[model samples]
Target: MTENSEANSPGWFDKPANINRLIVALVSACLVLLAVEAIFGKSFYDDHHPAHFPIEQMFGYQALIGFLAFVVVVFLGTILRTVIRRSEDYYDR
Candidate 1:
């Protein structure tokens, strides 16, 4: 790719330092959110939930669940890819 084309494309996040900064920023934001939730307590909807699950009231519970779900999805997708993928030359015959 030419310099001009690369410049026009999304190259801002291509650097390792940029990616690290992004990760740090996201983690910091999550920590701040967790701190706020701990100080202010749950929302009205969460407070009035039918089930009294202890884990639900924990700080960062939603984030933990979301991260775990994402991990599971990625893991499953990797496994499924190996199972369903065919040889590149399978259709050449």
Candidate 2:
């Protein structure tokens, strides 16, 4: 790669500092959202249909559920990939 080509490249997130900034921003946003929920979740949301199960009312329950759901989906996707994957030159014939 020539200097001209490298200079022309527009890789905004290719730098480690940018990646770290993005990570920090995302984590900070998550923490802020959790704090908001902790402060007003019961008064704002639970008034409609209060959860009977004690575990459902715990802090971060929704986040836990969402994370677990994502993990389950990725796990299923890996299993599906194993079932559908083909040999590298499958279409060369």
Candidate 3:
């Protein structure tokens, strides 16, 4: 991997500044969406769009549930990994 070839490579996010820019862009997008929801969510929900469950009417409920689901999936994946992991000497026998 010579310096010139590395510079010509196409890994845009390999640089620290690019990663930071990506993070900033994503966070800004989320904040903009959150602001839009905060300003419009109640009216949008109330305009003949009834929730299936009573709890769904609460603010930030969907975000909370999504985060909880993500946490549960990660936790289960960790446990599953430990249970199914192969020993280092698995093929040496």
Candidate 4:
């Protein structure tokens, strides 16, 4: 029957509840990492160096920098694609 076939389908993640649970788990993990870093993280660089700015001492600074860099790269890639993308037809000669 149609009901039996539907019940026997193997798509565990096809439900909205499963997707929500996955999102919650991932967010919870990120929060835990952030909390751990905030409580126990230490700078790896020398204190007297110019590179060791005060703002850099804050927790999650590296993550912020990485995320910003990723956004910049994606923006630049979008611009490059517009400049270098080929036409749909060039072999019609």
For residues 4-63, write the lDDT of model 1, one tens digit per residue. Answer: 232344776688786686678777987898788787675623444643788866777888
lDDT for position 92 in model 4: 62
Report the Cα RMSD per candidate. Answer: 6.4, 7.5, 6.9, 9.0
Question: Which lDDT tens digits does candidate 2 get at residues 1-93?
Answer: 122232334785578786686678778877998999888866745567777788777888888998899999999999999999999998996
Question: Residue 79, candidate 1: how far off, in angstroms?
Answer: 1.3
TM-scores for all candidates: the values are: 0.63, 0.67, 0.68, 0.60
Could you tally the backbone clashes for each prediction? 0, 0, 0, 0
Poorly placed runs, candidate 3 (over 4 Å): 1-9, 46-49, 87-93
- Shift of residue 47 alpha carbon in model 1, Å: 8.3
Ranking by lDDT: 2, 3, 1, 4
Candidate 4 yields a Cα-based lDDT of 0.72
Error of 4 at 75 (Å): 1.9
Q: Give the winner by lDDT.
A: 2
Which sections of candidate 4 miss by over 4 Å? 1-10, 41-56, 88-93
